[model samples]
Target: MKVEFFFDVGSPASYLAWTQLPKICAAKGAELVFRPMLLGAIFQATGNASPAAVPVKGRHSGIDLGRFAKRYGVPLVMNPHFPVNTLQLMRAVTGVQMHQPERFEHLLKTLFDALWIDALNLNEPALIGRTLIRAGFSIDEILALANSPDVKAQLRSTTDEALERGVFGAPTCFVGDQMFFGQDRLDFVEEALA
Candidate 1:
């Protein structure tokens, strides 16, 4: 089985999913495919509003996410800058996947940690550049690739494809034709994999 993970860095739940899915895939001997798509686009396409848009749900979600993080034994600090424009970050994901495939994993980890673990304001170009450099990526090269028309098109197509696949949210995992939404659904994911 191959697990297709559609995720965006801006979603805390996506980060929570990221913490566990890899290990599950590895243990199950399934190939893990990372699909980078913009959550904002998905929301627009599906007419889905963020869970955080509702104040009560947002507070409950924070506690729920923290519980999951504790269960997963991963660091989880909600970004103080709640709604980061991760356009460049998401673009960088596709760019690395396209150009520097070897660096994709490093890039993903760095960006995820910066936003969720370190809680950095990553939408700022300066911090993004510094973060990439520290992650052993060339700022100029990466930014160049990220800003390219091809990369932009790739992200757009991916987001469109996600919407077509009935994906209305991030951290969606597909086991063959079966779709599981949210990190909370990992048990079902594992069952389908089995």
Candidate 2:
């Protein structure tokens, strides 16, 4: 089965899904494709809102995410800088994908871990630069790609394509015509793959 995962760095649920889905796919002998999409754009196009927008759901999600983190044995924390505008971050993802495909995995892992595991405040460019540097990434190169017009267009086009795919949120996984939303749905995803 072919698995496509649509993600946004700013979403904690996306990070959780990232941690778990790869292992699931590997065990099932399925190929997992990581797709970086802009969650803000999806929400705008689909009239969806993050769980944070709702007080009860927001609190519950935090607890639920923690449970998943423990179950997966991966470090996770809600970023103190909640609501980080990941426009630049997502652009960097697209840029790496377009310019340096080899670095995509490392870049994705580094940024996802920074945003969710370390719970760093990635809202500031300066902090991002430092974080990238620590992750052994070229700060200049990534920033340049992130700021370029082509990269911006790539992110836009990817977001547009995601909207067309019935995706209204992050961590959406597809197995052919079957679409599963949320990290909690990995069991069903595994079933689909089988």
Candidate 3:
């Protein structure tokens, strides 16, 4: 089975999905492809804002996310500022995937945790470098790729592709013709697998 996960670093829900759903897919022997998208574009098209922008939903989502985090033992650092720009982080993910797949996953998770859970600004080069190093990644390699024109192009291209594919939200899962939206819909994904 194949599962394509459309995500953005700025989405807390995407971070939650990233931390948890991989285990489920792996257990089913499914191939997981991470598709990084631009949340800003998606929101602009849909006339939507960050969950934090919506008072009620934002409060509720925080509660719900807390449950998932505690259940999965995933520490979430709720960024008080909300919606930090992730252009560099997204490009870095693609670059990391190219140079080191395993470490890429590790760094992605680390960065997500630090941003969503620790509320750190991932856009800063120094902070990003520190996160990578803390995750046991080669800072030099990551910074080199993060600055590479090719990686930047890949990130931009990938974002365009994601938009063209009709992805308008984070945590959108594509399983063949089935499109599952939000982390709450993972049960549907499991059912589809079964």
Candidate 4:
């Protein structure tokens, strides 16, 4: 079996899912395909806003996410810069995944750790450059690829495909045609893999 993980590095929930899905797929002897999509585009296309758009729901969601983080024994510090614009970040991700598949997982880990675990404000270009440099990535190469027309088009196509797959949010997992919407629904994903 294979799990198509449609994700954006900007979403904390997607970071949580990223921490768990590898283990889940490993135990199930399943392949985990990383489908990097633009979450902002997904929201705009679907007319679905982040839970943070609603103050009460955002607070509740934060608490719930904390519970999950504790349950998973993983660190998740909500970025003070919540809702960071991730257009270039996602494009860089797509570019890396396309040009250097081997470094793809490393890049994901570095970015996720920066945003969720370290609580870095990745929305700032200088900070992002420093973070990537610290992670041993060449910022110049990343920038060149991220700004390339091919990378931009590929990210857009992936986001469009995600929309067609009924994906309205990040951390969406597909076990065959079974669409699981949140990191919290990973149990269902495991069952589907079984």
**Which candidate ranks first by TM-score, i.e. highest?**
4
Task: State the TM-score for model 3.
Answer: 0.87
Q: Which parts of model 1 have CA positions greater than 4 angstroms off?
A: none
- How far off is residue 94 in model 4, in Å? 0.5
Q: Give the alpha carbon lDDT tens digit for every residue of 95-128 in model 2.
A: 9999999999899999988888788899988999
Residue 96 in candidate 4 has what lDDT? 96
Q: What tens-digit string does per-residue lDDT give for candidate 3 at 96-123?
A: 8776677777777787878887788766
Q: Give the Cα lDDT of each candidate.
A: 0.91, 0.91, 0.79, 0.96
Error of 4 at 173 (Å): 0.5
In terms of lDDT, the poorest run of 10 residues in model 1 is 78-87
Q: Candidate 1: deviation at residue 92, Å?
A: 0.5
TM-score of each: 0.97, 0.96, 0.87, 0.99
Question: What is the per-residue lDDT of model 1 for residues 1-194, given as tens digits with 9 covering 90 to 100?
Answer: 89999999999988999889889999999999999999998888788977788989988989999999999999999888887888889998999999989988888899899999999998788998888888888888888988999999999999999999999998899999899999999999888888
Model 2 spans > 4 angstroms off: none
Clashing pairs for model 2 are: none
Candidate 1 differs from the real structure by a C-alpha RMSD in angstroms, to one decimal, of: 0.9
Between 1 and 4, whose lDDT is larger? Answer: 4
